[model samples]
Target: METVSVAIASIGRETLLDTLRSLAAVTRPAGVDLKVLVADDSKSGAATKLVTAHPIKSLDVTCLAVASGNISTARNALLNAADGGWLIFVDDDEWVEPDWLVKLFDCQKEFNADVVIGPVKPVYPDNTPDWLRRANPLYTDWGHRGKRLYTGRGGNTLVRVDFVRALKLRFDEAYGRTGGEDTIFFAQAAERGARIFATDDAIAREHVPQERLSMNFILSRAVRAGQSYGQMRLARHPDPLWHMVFALGALAKCGVAGSLALSFRLFDKARSFRMRQKLSLNMGKLRAVFGRPLAELYKKPD
Candidate 1:
């Protein structure tokens, strides 16, 4: 490994301090060069102040202040600024175990994978609802150790910097707020035959705020995710006829799932939520097949 940069983009000051503190605990083997790059996308530039007041230990850190908002732009800035051979991206609202980077590195060495993926579990703050905890909307896939994966979240992944740069793989700015930039970017890499693998051992934790406890919020996110999935698929085909066929299949799936979800609602809250979620996702896909935008979940809340 020439160098590995842990890239993080933070908008709010709400979670940046804790995230940096957690990174302070990261343990790396001797002679393995590692650095941290944090892009502060907050209007107030709070991340810089926090870093100055309390420096992260043993690691050379670069604090960059980019335009406020636009996560994809922040990530792109991080990629452009990084001089490392590998880039490991983690969300600013999350924390990693001391061995998180080590596990990702080991997985890459073993599999020769171009993209090494990991897991992220939700850490609900106090007063989180019981149902929301059970729903676990924030959790990404929990793949078996060494399992190969083509799709993953950017919150926890180690990407080959050179490969990405060479292929010009980047998070789409159009999705700076919609939150599927990672999906689209990774999907593009996979389409180009880039090897993406999963490491169940490499884990991160996303701190779920109390506001996200709303069932409405969770369902809305799922719907947007489904729409993004469909949009990506349609982008590949880009034919009106093909979109119509895909829309039919998606609509049928949504119909069946919706019926079952309605039935499940009377008896099982968990099953109903799950089914409703599935239905919502397919519905988003259904909407996308026809070329309409999904509900803009990332619109600046006014």
Candidate 2:
């Protein structure tokens, strides 16, 4: 029988139980042996302890102690531990629909895809600000169903294990702290002719904590995203001329966004916020081009 491993790299957040609970409730495909692997990156083995304390009776869940504060390292641990024909990745804070796994499998088979990505809907708290809710910057639109994508994210994604192993692909440890390892990994997979497809049916809902609702978090995340894009571009093209051209393009875009933000500052708050976000993203790209170090957003607290 074919094996499918649902992999999660977590730091023992309280919501992890909810994630496991949701997985336990999912409909397993016939003839597929489903397994859940959690790579715990905590020094105290918090996730392992939690799982031991609250075991889900229906699922065969195993928690691996990675003890690495780096998200990439944790994810790599999951990849190393997954012994299966296919692997599914989900965030520790996200809960999936009952048919999420089935839908992912169907999409992969339908498109003959090496990788399948699904959307992550945000669940905002009741106390969330109206403007922040209106903007909804956290929602990820992975294009229409069956649309081919050049790159994919780790969260709510399905991967053919053989393809990844054949390519000897592993999440880069260099991006462990600053995040975006998935972006780099998926971009490399695409470059190597991996077909990635999007599916809307495999839905996962991520709870947006109160801390993430601030403009500070939003702008910082945008910058990090831009930095990831810049890093990917540079890695793909090592030529100095290409780097220079890319930096110039980013600068031009940044200037345009900044100006638009200023123009809309008084009349359109939402548009201004969006333009500012764009400006910050381009600035991050420029920073990456210039080899400036970014803040380690994923660094574990001491």
Best by lDDT: 2
> Which regions of candidate 2 are displaced past 4 Å?
none
User: For every model shown, what is its TM-score relative to the native structure?
Assistant: 0.93, 0.95
Off by over 4 Å in 1: 294-302
Model 1 per-residue lDDT tens digits across residues 1-302: 56878899876455767777777787785567888898878777777777778776686788898854788888999999889788889888888889887888888989999999888888988776676567666676747777876666678888888888999878888888878788889989999888899888877888887777677888889888988888889899988899889889988988988998899889877777888888988988976776676554543311
1-302: candidate 2 lDDT, tens digit per residue: 98999999988898999999999999888888889999999889988988999988989999998888998898888888999989999999999999998899899989999999999999999987676676677886888889999888999999998999999999988888887889999999999989999999899999889899788998999999899889888988999999999999999999999999999888877778888889989988998998887678785822
Look at candidate 1 and tell me the lDDT of residue 79. Answer: 91
Worst lDDT 10-window in candidate 2: 293-302
Instruction: Give per-residue lDDT, candidate 1, residue 292.
Output: 73
